[model samples]
Structures are given as structure tokens and as C-alpha cells.
Target: MKLSILDQSPIPYGKTAEESLSASIELAKMADTLGYKRYWIAEHHDMSGLACPAPDIMLSRIGAETENIRIGAGAVLLLHYRPYNIAERYNMLAVLYPDRVDLGIGRAPGGSAEATIALSGNFLENVSKMPETLDELLSFFEGNFPKDHMYSAINPSPVPKVSPEPWLLGTSEKSGILAAEKGIPYAFGHFMSEQDGPEIVKRYHANTKSGKSLVAVSVICAETTKEAEELALSSQLWKIQQAKGEGKKGVPTVEEARAYNFSDEKKNDKIIAGNSGVVKQELEVLQEKYQTDEFMIVTITHSFEARRKSYELIAKAFGL
Candidate 1:
């Protein structure tokens, strides 16, 4: 029922890291004032042009500036950090911000072959463990959850838990299964998730341990079908460029994003765009397809004003 933003510390193709951070700070403040549920940052490391490699560092800065918004990594590169350390860092932040911090987790580092190796280091064997490694992570965050509890029909609250909201973030069915089996929330990376965004959500809910947790994450939402298509194009361009292994710092403005070309088939269902009525209809369809009434949308516009306006319009339409 709420919306959110996934800012990539977007350094336009030519901007400096400092400039990108500054722009993100401004954008965070704007989102905070607008009453968005959360503003999550993506983590991509070691790429010569990407700057948001460390979301924890950036999150502290975002948290320091915002009052009510839940600031977090749309995903932390869980495969890169130690389970114990991840727990401790997020626990400290949760204590500092209380209920406002979310620990969205993803196996991917949002980078390349070289970047992944660099991050894993000797931890390479660790990443290979996969879902087993994933269990350790969830247990660590739950603050001392024993290894055995993860396998049996067990609940995971036993110690001074690092209870920041937990979310399994990815585009695949595996991520969805992880969320449901563990009783955690699931966030599909719609920006990069290759179709079946709703189906992923459905799979998670169907297997949910107790069906008590709220299931949702961030997806770009825009106003007017045309505006939506335009913003989606911008997002798609970044995806395309990033996939081609072109790394850049900072986020791109709407204008900078519109410079690329795309096909309707590629974007038609990937993003949600429309006026209030259109938004309502579109979201309703998405909600039903996902089998959940809750969702977090990213009101994407290339310009700040347009983004803000899109937020306002969606908020009013959603009655949030």
C-alpha cells in the first residue's frame, strides 16, 4: 500500500562521486518530507564508475538527514560480508534508528566478475555455500538463532536480536522460496527482474511459514502512461548500460536518461505508469497478480519536481 525509491547513487555518465552523493542526500530529504515508506540504496562495488558500493556507509549519511523515512540498502551484498559482522552492524543501526532500518539482502553484489571476486576474497568458498550460507545470515540477524533451528519447524527469536526488518531481494524463484521458508519478507528487484514479478511474490506467499509478515519491496511507479514510459525508459537505459558493463557514478536526471532507445515490448510490463485512475487500475492489477494487497512503488521521474509530483499523486490515489 506504500511506495519507495531505489536510488543507485546515480552518478550520471560523467559526474563525480561527491556530486552523486550530494544529489542523493537532497533526494532523500525530499522523499522523507513526502512521506515515502523507505528510500533504499543499491550496492555495487569496485566498478571504476559506480560509487554506491558501500550501502552501510551511505545509509548512515541518509539516516542522519532524514527524520521518518526508513533508510536502507534495497539490498546489502550479503555474500560479501561475514554473518556475525552483518548482524552487529545492522543491530547497531537498528538500535540507533529503531524500526526505521530495513536489512534487505541479496546474494549478488550488483557488479561484474572482477568485482565479485574482489569482494569475496578468501570468502569465495563462503559464497559457494549459497542457501546454507543464507541460513546463517538470517540466524545471525535474528541474534543468536541456533543452527539447528534453521532446519526444523522453529521460530527464530531467542536473543537480543538484530531485528531490523528482513527481506530476501532478487528476481528469481530461489529468492522467493528463501523468503517464504524463512518467514521473512521478499522484495523482487523489478528494475532487473526478468518478468514474473508478480509470480515471484505469489510463490513466496504460498510457502510463507505463518503468513503474518508483510510482503513487498520497491518497484518504479510513475504518473501518466506517457510519463511512466519515459521514466521506465530512463531506468531501462541504466539497466542496459550497466548490463553492457558500463559503470558510472551518481544517478541520472530524467533528461540524461531519455537519451537512449528502447522497444515497447521490452518495457511494456516492466514498469507501472499512469494518472491517478490509471495508477489505481494498474496497481490493482499488479496487486491481484501478486496475491498481496501491500506494495512499495518507486515514483520515478527524471526530474526532482516530477518525482515529487508523482509521489504526491500516487499517495493521494493510494490514500496513504
Candidate 2:
């Protein structure tokens, strides 16, 4: 099985945004050396806990620091930006990193309602125009606009020898259908969605000519299952606080998480916490169900060391 990383660059309670971003670069380098398939950074706006707002910028720095692993935006929140702008930015990264760049597009707002408006007015309208926008974006990458098309006269600058691989990232069957129709790779956000992932992925494979798919999962691994669960408390509490519209600060410490009076209903089933062996076994089960060999693992913890160790343990378990 192939393992990859989806880094949100979470800012722990006491850590600064700078620290969280630096940790992302370090993690990317580590993943490169550990033989992971890719290192993807997420884009989030006006989210205090998540540091990254422009994954394209982070990818440039990470590309300079890493050697072989593919670097990309886990999802660039395509609703906010123009197709030409995104194409130029990632195309530049492809020029710099050659075949090691990926452009994972997503339609979610990726921020608060106010932030969404701040980034791009009429987000709902943009969502409705996604199909046409995606077609234009791919046209920019492939330089395949129709002969009489208005955009045929222009192209994204500094196109690389190999255009960055494009993958549609989403949590629903709608996204799967879009990706299949576009004939690009699909990445199912299993970590965030409550939808039927296996069915979505199966449909994507059956319809897509590309036949490429992966599942991005939330995971936390440690030397022991107890330690992993303890480390996960911070993320669990953060999600609870977020749903209640109170999570403006960075991720809370384990001590703070333990002290919080979480109701029995305030549980996050998305996080998979366990030792290396247990995580591997569960991932294997997911791989079989999803019928994909690649899994993008996203792990966030209060301590940077714990987050790093989680990836290391998983890598060792998979012998990557």
C-alpha cells in the first residue's frame, strides 16, 4: 500500500502560526526521505487552528526543501480564485519541481461565511459555475482549448515539461461524478465526510477513464494504542469547540482537552487512533473497501513531536 500525507499545519494552543508552518515544511522533508508518495498541504482561511491559507505558497517552499515526494495543495478551495491564476501558480511549481507537483482542486468554502465572502463574493454562484471553471482550468493545464474558444489565444505562463497532476478532492458522490466526467484522478475526503465513501469511490472508478483514486483519512499512531488515544484528545476537543463556533484559538493541549466537560454526544468518529499495527490493519481494511492502493493520512496533535512521531510510526508499520 502507498502512504501519503495531508498536512493542515495545525497551530497548537501555545504555538504560533509560524511554528506550525515550519513544522509542515519539516514534515514534508521527513516524508520525502521516508519514501512516502506525496506531501500535500491544505488551504484554510480565517481558521485560527489551521495555519495554511495559501497552499501554493507553502508548496513552493516545501518543494525547495524536499527531494522526491510529490508536493501539492490537498485542496485549493477552487471557488475563491480564477482558473487562470491557480493554473499559473501551480504551473510555476511544476516548472520548479518537475513531475513532483499535484494540483488538487476542491469546491468547499474552506472558511467561515464571512471569510468566504471576504475571499470571493457570491460563493454559491461560483459553486454553480464549477463545471465550466474546471473545464477552463484543465484547458489551461493541457493547452487544449477549442479552436474558436475565447481562451484559445492565452495560456498559463511558464508551462512545465510535465504539467502538475490534477486531482479533484471532495466528500460526496457529486464530486466523484465531476471527477469521472472530467477524467481526472479523484481523492475522497473520508476524514471529513459522513457520506458513503466506498460507494463514491466505486462509482468514480467505474466511470473515470483515469481510474486513479485515493482516500484521505484522519489517523494518529503511536507506540501504544493508549498513547495514541491520549494524543488525539486535542483534535477531538477542537472539533467539538469548532462545531459550537468557539474554536478561534489554536489546538488545545491534552491537559485542557481532558479538563473540558465534553458531552457523550460530542464525539468525533473521524479520527482513527491506535498503535502502528492497529492503524495499519484498519488502513488495510479501508484500502480493500475503497479498492485503492494509496491513502493520504492527515494527523494533527497538540505536540509537534507527537504529530511527527505518528507519521514515522505509520511509515515504519507500512515499511515505506
Candidate 3:
């Protein structure tokens, strides 16, 4: 099983965007050295704390800084951009990195109205037709939309097509069907949706048509479960605000995470936050129950020391 890394450039309370990006770069380098399979950064626009509004650009910077590490946007919010443009942009990245690049796609706007409007401009009209819009985008990437079959107006590129693997990500069952029907790989966001990991993975794997199917989950690792949970909350708070569309409550003071509320314990355990021994049992169970071939982890601890521990423990646990 292959494991990957996903970071959305979470803005720690009181830190600047530059700080978040710099930290992501550092983490990317660490993951590469530690034998993590891939390092994918997410794209979020106009969030007070998120620094990855343009993941393509950031992935380029990250790819330049690391070697032999698969670097790509954890996802491009395909809803917000034209398919041809996305195809070309990611295609260029693929050219630079060859098979080392991947293109993760999600249906979410990756932001709210004001931010979407600001970032997408006239393209905002394209939002209402999400499934169709995604179809158009994929048409460009696949170079086979067959405009004659439809009355819509879309021009796809025949040259420099994006050959990178496309990973469809979502929090709902509908996304599973969409990914399966389209013959694309799918990833369940267990971190955001608070769903059962084994069930989601099983559903996707059972229904997947032809592409490689994978599951990505979130976790915080430490010598003990308590420390993992504590660090995870701190890491997730920075993410929740960015994702839940709330304005920042200002930079987080060091102690604020202690006071914040995330989901209950039943919810947190899916991330499998614990020591090496405990997490291994969890992963083996997940693999068997989910019948999965590939698994990715979004480790939530952001401290340099904690992040390293998270990767090391998982690798050791998996005997990788």
C-alpha cells in the first residue's frame, strides 16, 4: 500500500500566510526524506489563514525543492476553473516532473462566495453546473469530450494533454458514484466529513470501475494517544476555520487549541491517533475491511518534531 501526504497550508493562529507556505515546504522536504509516497498541497482561496490559493504554483515551488517526491495539488477545485486551462496547467507540471505529478480534483468551491468571485471572476457562472462542469474539465484532460455529442461550447487541447493521474475527492456518496462512473480514482475526506473510514473505502472499492482506488485519512501520532489527540485538535482548528468558511478569530495563541472543540472521541479515532503499535492494528483492520490497495494519511500535527514523529511512527508501524 502507498501512503501520501496532504496539507492545506493551515494558518496557525497569529501566523502569516508566508509562514504557512514556508512550513509546508519544510514538511514536503521532510516527507520526501522519510519515504512518504507523495506530498500533495491543497488549494484554498481568500481564507484569512490558508496560503495555498494557487496550488499549481506552490506545487512547482515544492517540486523544485525536493527530489523523487511526487508533488501535486492535493486537489484543484475543478469547479472553479475551465478544464482546458486546468489540463494545460497540470500538463505543464507533468512535463516538468513526468510521472511524478498527480492531479487531485474536488467539487467543492474551496472557498465562499466573495472568495470564489474574487478568484474565479466571470467563471463564477460556471459554478451551478458542477457535474457538467467537471465533465467539461475532464474532457479537456482526456482530449475526448466529443463536442458533437453535446451542444455546449468547450475547446479542449489536443497537444500537451494532462497525463497525470486524477484523484476525485469528496465527502459524500455522490462523489463515489461520479468517480466510479468516470473511471477515476476516489478519495474520502475522513477528516472533514467525520464518516466511518472502512465503510467509505469499501463503497468506493466495490463500485470502482477501472482506475486505481485509494483512501486518504487524517491522523495525529505521538508516543501516547492523549498527546496525539491534543496535537490533532490544534492542527485541525487551523483547518476547520479555513474550511467551515468562518472568518479567523485572529491568530491562535499557543493555548487556544486547549479551549477549542472538535468532534467527539468517536470521531477522532478514525484518524487513528496513537502510538506505532496501536495505529498498525488500525491500519491492518482498515485495509482488510475496506479492501483497499492504497492509503494516504494527512497527519495533523504541525510541529516539526511532531510531524516527523507522525511519519516515522506510521512508517515503522507499517514496516515500510
Candidate 4:
């Protein structure tokens, strides 16, 4: 199995955004040394817990700090900006980093309802235009704009020797279909949706005529199964709050999660948390079910140390 990481650059309680960002860079370096295949950063706007609202900037810093590990956006909210703009920015990064860049674009608003409106000025209209925007972005990369298209007369400059590898990110079957139709790589957001994993992967494989498929999973690994369970609770309350549309910016402590009232189903869904051996076993089951060898793991923990340890333990378990 090829294990990769999806870092949110999450701010733990009482930590500054700077600290969270610093931790992300440090983690990227660690992942590079640990033999992980890729390290993708997430973009979340107007969220206190996540510091990486601008993955392009973060990618530059991460790429500068780490060697050998591939770095890119987990998903840049495609609805917020012009496709030409995204294409140019990442193309610039590709010039600097070459084959190390990956651009994963998604249509979802990466923020609250209010922030979504703030981002694009017109949410629904911008979302409705995502397909066209994706086409424009790809045209810039492939230099294949349709005849008479406005951009056919123009070129996004500073084009790298190797263009960025673009992947469509989605949590539903619709995303898979669009990706397959576009003939681009598809990354299933398994971490975001528990019920849709098996079906989404199946559909993506069946429909895709080209490009590989990847799944992102939420994982928490620790020294012992009991300890891992305790640490994993940090996300239970956070998940509950998110469902209530009251999710906080930073992670809740295990103590806070223990104090909150939550059903077992919500707490366990889409999460693979346990000791190294247990995590490995659970991941195997998921891999078998998804029929994919590539997995991008997202870990949410209260402490930076714990988060790093989680990845470290998992990497050791996978022998990556």
C-alpha cells in the first residue's frame, strides 16, 4: 500500500495559527524523511482551527522545507477563483518544484455558509460555473483550448517543464463521474463521508476511462489500542459540533469529548483509530473494500506531538 498524508494545518486549542502552520511544515519534513509518497495541504477559509486557507503559499514553504516528498493542495476551492488564476499559480509552483506539485481541485465551499458567500461573492452562481472553470484550468495546462475560445489566443506563462498533475476531489459519486468524464485523476474524500466510500470507489473504477483513483481516510494511531481510543475521542465532540453547525476552530480535548454526549455510531464512522496493529488491520479492510492501494490519511489530535506520533506509528506499521 502507498500511504500519503492530507494535512489540515489544524490549530490546537491555545495555539496560534503561526504555530499550526509551522507544525505543518515540520510535519511535511517528517513525512519526507519517513518515506511517505505525498504530503497534501488542505484549504479551509474563515475557520479558526485550520490555518491553511491559502495552500499555494503553504505549498511553496513546504516544498522549500522538504526534499523528495511530493507537495500540493489537497483541494483548492475551485468556485472561489478564476480557473486561469489557479492554473497560473500552480504552474508557477511547478516551475519551482517540477514534478513535486499536485493540484487537487474541488467544487465544495471550504468554509462556513457566511464565508462561502464572502469568498466568491455569489455562491450558487460560482458553484454552477465549476465545470466550465475546470475546463479552462485544464486547457491552460494542456494548451488545448477549443478553437475561437478567448484563452486560445493567450497562454498562461512561466509554464514549468512539467505541468502540475491535476486531480478532482469529491465526496460523492457525482464527483467520480465528472472526473471520469474529464479524464482526470479522481480522489475520493472518504474522510468526509462514511457511507459513500464503497459505492463511490466502485463507481469511480467502473466509470473511469483514464487516470488512477485515490481515497482519503481519517486515521488516528497510537502506542496502544486503549490510548488510541482515548485520543481519538478528541474528534467525536468536534464531529458532533460540526453536525450542529457549531464546530469550533480548534480541536476539542479528549476530556472535552468525554464530557460531551454522543452516540457510538457518529463517533466511530469514517474513523480508523487504534494501536499500530489495529490501525493497519482496519486500513487493510478499507483498502480491500475500496480496491485501491493509495490512501491519504488525515489525523486530527489536540496536541501537535500526538499528531506527529500518530503518523510516525502508522508509517512504521506500514513499513513505508
Candidate 5:
């Protein structure tokens, strides 16, 4: 099985954005040396908790810092930027990093409504143009557009010897169908929504030509199951804040979570947490259910060191 990291650069309760970003770079280097497959950064705008608003810039810095593991945007909110610009930036990254670039795209706004407007001037218009934007992005990679197409007259450049591998990141059947139609890799954001992951993976494999499937999930690993559960309270509290639209700044500490008094049902609904053995068991079950060999972990905790150790434990568990 292959393991990857999808870092949102979550700003812990006391850490600054600079510290969070530095942690991301350090984590990328760690993953590279630990024999992991990929280190993908997320793009989230106007979220004080998420330090990475520009994944392209982070990818460039991470690419410079890592040697082997692929560096990429976990999901660049494609609707916010021009297709040609997106194409050029990623292709330029490919030029800098060669075959070690993965370009994952998503249609989500990646921010609040007002921030979305600030990003693209018109969120709805950009959302409506997503399909065409995606097509134009792919055309830049293919270096050709249909003769009658308006983009046929222009080509996005410094096309690398190998284009960055494109993956559609989504949580539903629509995303599966689109990725299948496009014939690229597909990633299911199991951590972002309550959608049925096994079904999504099943449908994606059933429809895709390449049969590539990736699941991004929330995982917290510790030395013991009890310790893991305790650490996970913070994530639960963070989710509660997000649900209430109050968690836009930073991830809360474990103490904050304990004080929040989240419902037991809500705490049990998500978060795969335990010791290495238990985490491995849960992941193995997921692998069997999805019939895939890859899993991308998204871990957010109060302490940077704990977050780093979580990945380390998971990597050790998986023998990655």
C-alpha cells in the first residue's frame, strides 16, 4: 500500500501562520525521506485556520525542499482562477520538478461566499464556467484544442516534457462521472463530507479508464488507543466550530475540545483514531472496501509535534 499526505497547514491554537507553513515544508521533507508517495498541500482562502491559500507557491517551495515524494496541490479550487493561468503555473512546476508534480483540481470555493467573491469577482459565474475551465486546462496539457474552439488560437506554455498528472478531487457521483469521462485519476474527499466513500470509489473504478482511486481521510494515530482518542477531541471540537461557522481562525486545543462538550454522536461519526495497530486495521478495511492500494491522510491536531508524530506512526504502521 502507498501512503500520502494531504496537509491543509492547519494553524494550531498558538502557532502563527509562518510556523504552520514551515511545518508543512518540514513534513514534506519528512514524508519524502520516509518513503511516502506524495505530499499535497491544500488551497483554502480566507480561513485563518488554513495557512495555505496559494498552493502553487507552496508547491514550488516544497518542491525545492523535497527530493523524491511528489508535491502538489491537494485540490486547487479551479473555479477561482483562469484555466490558462492554472495550466501555466502547474506546467511550470512540472518544469521545475519534472515528473514529480500532481495537479488535483476541485470545484469547491475553498472559502466563505464573500472570500469567494474577493477571489474571482463572481463566484457563481466561475462555478458555471468550471466545465469549460477544466476543458481548457486539459487542452493546455494536451497542447491542442478543437479547431473551432476559441482557445485553439492560444497555447499555454513552457509545456513540460511530462505534464503534471491531473486528478479530479470530489466527493460525489458527479465528480466520479466527470473524472471517468476525462480519463484522469480520481480522489474522493472522505474527510470533507459525509458521502459514501466505498460507493464513490466503486463507481469511480467502474467508470474510469485508468481505474485509479485515492481516498483522503482524517486519521489520528498515537502510541495507544486511549491517547489517540484524547488527542482526537480537538479535531472533534474543531469540526463543531466549523459546523457552527465559528472556526475560521485556528484549530482548538484538546482542552478547548474537552470544554466544548460535543455530542457523543458527533464525535463518533468521523475521525479514524487509535494506536498504530488499530489505525492500520481501519485503513486496511477501507482499502478492502475501496479496492484501492492508496490512502492520503489528513491529520489536524493541537500540537505540531503531535501532528508530525501521527504521520510518523501511520507510516511506520504501513511500512511506508
Candidate 6:
């Protein structure tokens, strides 16, 4: 199996955003040396726990620090920005990193309603025009705009020798259909979605020209299954609280999570927490269901060291 990473740069309870970002850099460098295929930073806005709002900016810095791993925005929320500007920013990264850059595009707001309006005046309108925007963005990369088109003469520069590989990220079948129609690579957010992932992936492959599919999953691995579950408590509680419109101060400590009034009814089954062997077995089950060989793992824990260790254990488990 080919392993990759999706970093949200989660801030621990008492840690600052700066510390979270620094940890992301350290993680990326570690992933590069561990033989992971890619390192993707997610973009989120106005969220204290998830520190990164501009993945493009972070990717520029990460590319400089990591030697070989492909660095990218797991999904640059394309709804808030113009295609040309998005193309230009990623193109610059491509110039700097050569073939090790990816441009993963998604249509979600990636923020709250107020933040969405602040970024783009009409988020709904932008959603309606996604097809056109995606077409224009792909054209900028392929340089295939018609001669009479308004953007034909313009270039998203300084263009690199190799264009960034573009991937469409989604959690639903609509995204799969769009990716298939566009003929680009597809990345399914299995960690976040409640939909039928195998069905979506199957449809994407049935019609997709690229035939490339990647499943991004939330996972936590440790020396023992009990240890992994204990480490995952903070993240699990944070998510539960966040769903109830709280937890803005970042991931809480395990002690805090343990003290919380969370009940079994609020437990999150999405996070796959276990020992390395158990985690590998669960991932293999997912692989069989999704019929894909690549998985992008995302893990968030209160302790940075534990988070790092989780990735390390997973890497060793997969022999990456």
C-alpha cells in the first residue's frame, strides 16, 4: 500500500497556532524521511483548533523544508477564489518544487457562514459556477483555452517545467461524478464522510479517465490498542464538542476529555484507533472495500509526540 499524510495542524489545548504550524513542519519533514508518498496540508478558516487557513502559503514553506515528499493543499477551497489566482499560486509552488506539487481542489466553504461571505460574497453563486471555474482552472494548467477565450493570452506564471498534478477532493458521489467527468484524479474523504464510500469510488472509477483514486482516513496507531484509544480521547472529545457548537479553543487534553460529560451515545466510530497491527488490518479491509491501494492518513492528538509516533507506527506497519 502507498501511504500519504493529510495534516490539519491541530492546536493542542494550551499550545498556540504558531506551535501547531511548527509541529506541522516537523511532521512533514518526518513523513518525507519515512518514505510517505505525499504530505498535504488542509485549509480551514476561522477555526482555532485547525490552524491552517492558507494551505498554499504553508505548502511553499513545507516544500522548502521537505526533500522528496509531494506537498499540497489537500483541497484548496476553490469557491472563494478565482481560478486564475488559484492557478498562479500553485503554479509558483510547482516552479519551486518541480513535479512534487499537487493542486487538490474542493467546493466546500471551508469556514462558517460569516467567514464564507467574507471570503466570497455569494458562496451559493460560486457553487453554481463550479463547473466553469474548474474548467478554467484546468485550462490554466493545460494551456488549452480556445484562441478567442478572454483568458487565452494570459498565463498563470511563472510556469514550471511540469504542471502540478490536480486532484478533485470530495466526500460525496457528486464530487465523484465531477471528477470522473473532468478526467482528473479523485480523493475521497473517508474520514469525514457518512456516505457510501465504496459506491462513490466505484462510480468514479467506472467513468473516470485517470482511474486514480485515493481515500483519506482518520487513523491513530500506537504500541498497543489500549494506548491508541487513550490518545484518541482528546480528539474524539474535541470533535464531539465541536459538533455541539463548542471546542473553539483547540484540542483539549486527555484529562479534560476524561472529565467531560461525554457519553457513549456521543462516541465517534469514524476514528480508527488501535495498535499498528490492528490499524493495518482495518486499513486493508478498507482497501478491499474501496478497491484502492492508496490511503492518505490524518491523525490528531493532544500530544504532538504521540501524533508523530502514530504516523511513525503506521509507516512501519505498512513498510513504507
Listed in order, each prediction's TM-score against the native is 0.80, 0.98, 0.84, 0.96, 0.96, 0.98
Between prediction 1 and prediction 2, which has the larger TM-score?
2
In candidate 5, the residue pairs with backbone N, CA or C atoms under 3 Å apart (3 or more residues apart, or in different chains) clash, namely 49-249
lDDT, candidate 4, 16-92, per-residue tens = 89998889989999999999999999999988678988999999988898889988899998999988889889999
> Could you give candidate 5's per-residue lDDT for residues 1-320 as a string of tens digits?
99999999999888899999999899999999999899999999888789989999999999998899998998999988888999989999999999999999999998888999888888888878877788889988897887888888776678789999999999988888889888889999887777788887888788866769889989999999998888998888887788878887689988887777555436645689999999999999988888888999999898988988999999998887
For candidate 6, lDDT tens digit of each residue in 1-320? 99999999999989999999999999999999999999999999998699999999999899999899999888899999999999999999999999999999999998899999999999999999999999999999999999998889999999999999999999999999999999999999999999999999999999966679999999999999999998889988999878878888889998997787766546778899999999999999999999999999999999999999999999999888
Question: How high is the lDDT of residue 73 in model 3?
Answer: 78
Question: Which wins on TM-score, candidate 1 or candidate 5?
Answer: 5
Candidate 2 per-residue lDDT over residues 228-292, each given as its tens digit: 99889999999988888877888989999889887764678888999999999999989889999
- Please, what are the lDDT tens digits per residue for candidate 1 over residues 180-232? 87787778765456757777776777797564223343334455677666665
lDDT of predicted model 2: 0.93
Residue 175 CA displacement from its true place in model 4, Å: 0.3
Q: Please report, in order, the local distance difference test score of every candidate based on alpha carbons.
A: 0.67, 0.93, 0.72, 0.87, 0.88, 0.94
- TM-score, prediction 5: 0.96
Error of 5 at 226 (Å): 0.9
Judged by TM-score relative to the true structure, which candidate is superior, 5 or 6? 6
Error of 1 at 283 (Å): 1.6
The candidate scoring highest on lDDT is 6
| Candidate 2, superposed: residue stretches over 4 Å from native | none
> Which of the two candidates, 2 or 5, achieves a greater lDDT against the reference?
2
lDDT at residue 128 of model 1 (Cα atoms): 73
List of clashing residue pairs for candidate 3: 13-251, 13-252, 14-251, 14-252
**Cα distance off (Å), candidate 4, residue 135:** 0.9
In candidate 1, residue 299 scores what lDDT? Answer: 41
If candidate 1 were superposed on the true structure by all CA atoms, what would the RMSD be? 4.7
What is the TM-score of candidate 3?
0.84
